[model samples]
Target: MADGAPAAAATDETALRRDLAAAYRLIALEGMDDGIYTHISARLPEGPDGQKRFLLNPFGLRFDEVTASSLVTVDESGAVIDDPHGAGVNAAGFTIHSAVHMARHDAACVLHTHTVAGVAVSSVEEGLLPLNQWSAQFHGQLAYHDYEGIALDLGERERLIADLGAKNVMILRNHGMLTCGRSVAEAVKLTLNLERSCQAQIGALGMGLTPRPLSDEIAAHTAAQYQKGYDRIEVDGRPDPEWAALLRRLETAAPGYDA
Candidate 1:
């Protein structure tokens, strides 16, 4: 039984690594990455003592360079658990990701990005405007955190969680955007949607025309309509049809992530 438990854990972690690696490649493919700045993290199985650990990219690797075996494991104290040869996880990046992982147990995957559109929208006073279906999906689910320079201090984690509250998406004021989910595919989906929302908002507002925004009631309805159906839907390697199709696309477009 003990041996079987270890083997099963290994198998589960292998699947997670593959999914996370694939997410990195997909993000890079979509031009959502910011060199090596932003981060995507996955919470690992807890220890008997309930110690938390996470899998994060090595500090210097570009998103496209990430592979399943190249990820590094780290604990809350910024200690690297595995891969002594790793470039080490980014200390500043850990501050943002650890805050979400520790507070929101349901957020198994946390994705952060510093895309131009995301940052542009974050800088605006209105936040994400529900201008379209993609934008409406985040209507009430989006939160905001006033930027506080670089996220190098562990002390900031408290305010980060407080700002995020129960929402799965956030705009780091003057910074970038964040999205979290119970599965890697779910997180990827949220990131893609949120990024699209920001892009649309910027593109629309960039034009001088005063576009009509959705009514609050309608936006709320659409938010639920768009995302609530897929809540934690992926299981046992069977993602929803959308995520399954994405993985298939990766097989052809970005093949080496699973390696």
Candidate 2:
């Protein structure tokens, strides 16, 4: 967070910071951002003392303005440590992210967005219809959590976790979308696909015509394919080509996240 501040597992934390910052910028660049409202967060590897923590964008900074060094480290209790920016964090961000980070240890990064289409889909009773390939990937993997208001209550974390059980993505009813991943790249990719799928659904529904949804069997098969990995061109286990391309896009569009 600050110069000379001690970082737990510096190498791993540094990499996560860059990746998380890049996700924030990409979201903003793609017009998926909601001012400084939504948050993208990453879980930090354990330190020597085995303290559980995660990185979240400091409150008040727009996603496009986020840099690797500007991210804040939040402990398991949602308190910011090594507060370099001293910006604290949005209460809703802490509540939502803390819920997932605590309940889902496997989620290395979590992305939340309030895009118009996303909110529209969330408000729908059907919730993220599996009408397209982009949406099919989450056919049965998407969860739904009823909005209990502004998410300021820490007590709501339990209900949130219960609603999101064993799912990688969720639609907060009357709110927006949330996605978590084993990596930042995965999280961003899922969010991108989710947003596209939402937009497509909205467009289809706006036509006042009955839309043909993907068959349940097809949706299941597509979700399986995604689980097997798609567009993954890995060489010696380095960054996947899809992720590399995304980073390059960020570099050209909104650089300086690695700072």
Candidate 3:
């Protein structure tokens, strides 16, 4: 046992740290990060003391500075349980992520971001339009939560959860974007698709040409195919080939994320 942790638990924690760190680095590489703000968190498969805790980037480190060893562990309440650098978590981050983690047991990882494209679509009244293939992926799978200030109060957690019921992606009205998944890779993939969809919508809207949307039948069919990982090669039921290629790219461009 490592540090009194069972062998299985220790292994799971190690993998989570490396994967979460890699996610942060990938997001930074894509220019989706907003300095030290925004967060990507993974729930520990087995937390210390047998309680539910998650791994998040330390509050002070930039995304590029985050590493597997530097990630902090916090309970569902967002209280720090283990932080090698003695750093705290952002309060607003805690409020938002904790609500999802507590409400959705299947959500092993949660990714949130603030990008120009994302915020632009979020502020609009109609939300994400099914104007492109990327947008179609979220046809019936996305939800929206009206913004309620800066998300500092614990009282707002219920509303946040309520608004996000059974949905994997959410637009935080006037705020940004949020996505959760059963793994770090899945969460990151969702973030990438959502961000790209928002960017495409913004661009389409900018052209002043009325963008034609996919019909409801086609959109729903496309969404179903996407859920099945259609039109792409897969390994072990995930887009492993693409994910592996991404990791190779990350290894050259931004090394040591898994340190």
TM-score of 1: 0.94
The whole-model lDDT of each prediction reads: 0.88, 0.86, 0.87
Candidate 1 regions exceeding 4 Å error are 1-3, 232-239
Model 1 per-residue lDDT at 87? 90
lDDT of 2 at 173: 98
Model 2 is weakest, by summed lDDT over 10 consecutive residues, at: 230-239
The root-mean-square deviation over C-alpha atoms between each candidate and the true structure, in angstroms, is 1.9, 3.7, 2.7
Q: Please give, for residues 56-155, the per-residue lDDT of candidate 3 as tens digits.
A: 8999899988999999988888788888878888756778898999899889889999999999999999999999899999999989999889888899
TM-score of each predicted structure versus truth? 0.94, 0.92, 0.93
| TM-score-sorted candidate list, best first | 1, 3, 2
Decide which is better by TM-score, 2 or 3: 3
Number of colliding residue pairs in model 3: 0
Give the true-structure RMSD of model 1: 1.9
**Residues 68-179, model 1: lDDT tens digits:** 9999988976578886336987777778898899899999999999999999998988888889989989888889999889988777889989999999999999999999
List the candidate 3 regions with Cα displacement exceeding 4 Å.
Answer: 1-5, 230-239
How far in Å is the alpha carbon of 105 misplaced in model 3?
Answer: 0.6
